[model samples]
Target: MTMPTSLCPYRMQVHHIKQETPDVWTLSLFCHDAWPYEAGQHALVSIRNSADTLRAYTISSTPGVSPFITLTVRRINGGAGSQWLTREVKRGDYLWLSAPQGDFTCAAHPAGRYLLLAAGCGVTPIMSMRRWLAKYSPMTDVEVIYCTRSPQDVIFADEWRAFPVTLFAEEGAAQGFIPGRITREHLACIPHLKDRTVMACGPAPWMEFVEEQVKSLGVTRFWKEKFFTPSAAPATSGLKISTLQPVREFYAPVGATLLEAMESNKVAVNAACRAGVCGCCKTKVASGDYTVSSTATLTEQEIADGYVLACSCHPKSDLVLA
Candidate 1:
């Protein structure tokens, strides 16, 4: 069956909850009907209570492996959605979720060799791709490097042992694992780094480091997914945005994302995965000078043609969006 539309949210029952770590839990959700999803795509999950909270989570389950989909969530100290999923939700609980959406997937860009780097909970999407590759593309050579605080904090550690995996622990070291943060020296050890496709996911800092390292190696094909919205620097100028569909205009303060600015002014815009990894908030720019922090979901031509991701874009000057 086809996936549900973004404008429509589907209800899924929690089939089971598995605790991978003290702070991380995996929730298996069963839909009333079949829903197809690719590995590495994420879904926007919402908790319908007094306060409606929505957040996007990467799917960790491989397609066709089971009748249900899975989301692995890590509890953040003050994060409402993460805390709800980890502490409040349970089996038989129902959640409203959007269809699978994101561009970070092996199916989108196939390669002969892949080096997957993940830190903390960022391993979710990479693990999905790994499972899919094992079942569908056995001939492909894949290597995974997962970084966490310690061995006790690693998610799905036992399952990852079956593959070519390397664990990097910062606080402590263990046998068959590296100690300390990932560095350029570590990336230099990989053979023919430029010839392999490098996909890294995790916090913005970790992904930025990985991106710089990959660029230094002259890697042509590199993909990255950040779970959190990028922190934008203070803007020097304000923005004037004009929308066409509803025919509205508004003034956005400097350093504010277009999505945030529009939402604050009560402008309706469907957005999911505000990190810019999902293309849900893509809009045509009628005219504007803007700076995008991340372009993982956009093509080079699209940027040239005045297309921007509203979630991660900061206005450099006055803007008009179509």
Candidate 2:
């Protein structure tokens, strides 16, 4: 997706890289600017080799720390972004990043008790929160439920020990870790479960399980920010879209996202969290209609002014870009 010039990128050098687990690695990028961001937010990353290919990776380092930002990546067998980050990149390489952007942060409200749940590399962002909490709200009550394949593959194995963590595994055994997925029994074990704000991140199914299990246990303040890039086949009756600046035109499927359609047609538009959580893809709708799944980062006033987040909206009529 095209990135906005105002939010173009901060060029940072790769300071260090560490293999966190068998298939997971952490990249520590040297921060040249005083890049400010909350603990749980993620940045849009892109290397010069593949400038147009950007992916979101959460910042695992705390903002309180300077000169560095860490991103923990889990290698996915067929995943292009993760694989490149974990294997292809070398030390001292430069990476372009959009300013940290996301709403999945607890920095503003740090005094409350929290229940952090993570699986696999989802622990990346969770670690940021834990670090921030430890540094700032040192007395705040916190509990964690970390899951992985086995003891051998637990990311940040020793770091999580500082907090009250319940480990769940789908395979081999460990003394303190359980041997199955998170269940109702586990939620019931955490003291004051109903009062703690629950935050979970992981695979869709695992997150779904966490949502259902936690709500069933009477928890209402649940927070999770998932970066989902929705996909679909372009419709046979293709709908056309036009961009303003240079008057570019393209045809997008009826139900397909307007942003995805533009990307397919090589139209330049910036998108951070393809899920509409970040408003980087905001575009003025010069003269057409579209449907939206969530208002997300747009204000009611902005909607009245014809601004739409291209990622979440589908073309209802032929669109004219402003």
Candidate 3:
């Protein structure tokens, strides 16, 4: 596969950090040069201490509002990358980051009305879209549905409250908030549900639930960004991969994702949104058998062209990659 040489990594300094929730923090990064990015896109970030551990995070700040880029991250208990950013990283520290990438943006497909659904830290990208609409498309009709464990867990609560928002909480319902998980009945009541474009972002199970509910409502235009990967069955065999760019070969462990395998063997493959929602890890299979997960961000034509998302694919047999 031919990689874009212009998408090289750049360095940014951490200007500030703000703790939003107990487990979530937002980092403001100052770039030496102008950072061009659209709302709802993500950046691939790598810490200086953990050179090989790269992670993708959505850009939370609007394009024209600030000189710096912001990323809101939720620290998972044992996640090395998240833990490092929330606990160890400090202001003045520098990190390597790739240019913004991903197709989960409203600019790609404009709609008359929009329904934005988000849960937990998944609100980051949606927040970007919201800010953009508030600034550039002020007259657009938009509604937001946000879910969290409790009132305290809501990220950007103040900003979100400025718009038309419906909150769902698992505990302690507050004013303008509902209790429990979003149900089909809840979605069924939305006026003109079928006419509005739905954009959802959240954990895998939450996204799946929302997708089914929206489809049941006869909504035709739906776009989603899932932050977590769905559970996959165990792999029965190992795989051998040949990579291009910096030509190299490696052995992938059974059940390991192609991207994970490549990373384990020290083969650098530019990847963002490791959950497979982004096409950054796309590669052409020169000669190989592979089973790509259903969550892969690939079109039918791309699949026919022998392209696969390394983050969501497992090798079915020894493979040779372009």
lDDT of each: 0.81, 0.78, 0.80
Worst 10 residues of 2 by lDDT: 227-236
Tens digits of lDDT, candidate 1, 1-322: 2224443367788999999998899999998866789999888886443223467889999997645799999987766678899999989988877778888999998999999999999999999999899999999988889999888888888788778898899986889779989998888888778888998899866898899888888888999887663233333336777788888777778657787777656676656678776676787787878888777779999988888888889988888887
lDDT tens readout by residue for model 3, 113-133: 889999988999888998888
User: What's model 2's lDDT at 29?
Assistant: 89
Show the colliding residue pairs in model 3: 1-322
RMSD, one per candidate, in order: 6.4, 6.2, 6.9
Clashes of 2: 2
**Worst lDDT 10-window in candidate 3:** 228-237
- Backbone collision count in every prediction? 0, 2, 1
Candidate ranking (lDDT, best to worst):
1, 3, 2
Off by over 4 Å in 1: 1-8, 49-52, 229-271, 275-288, 292-310, 317-322
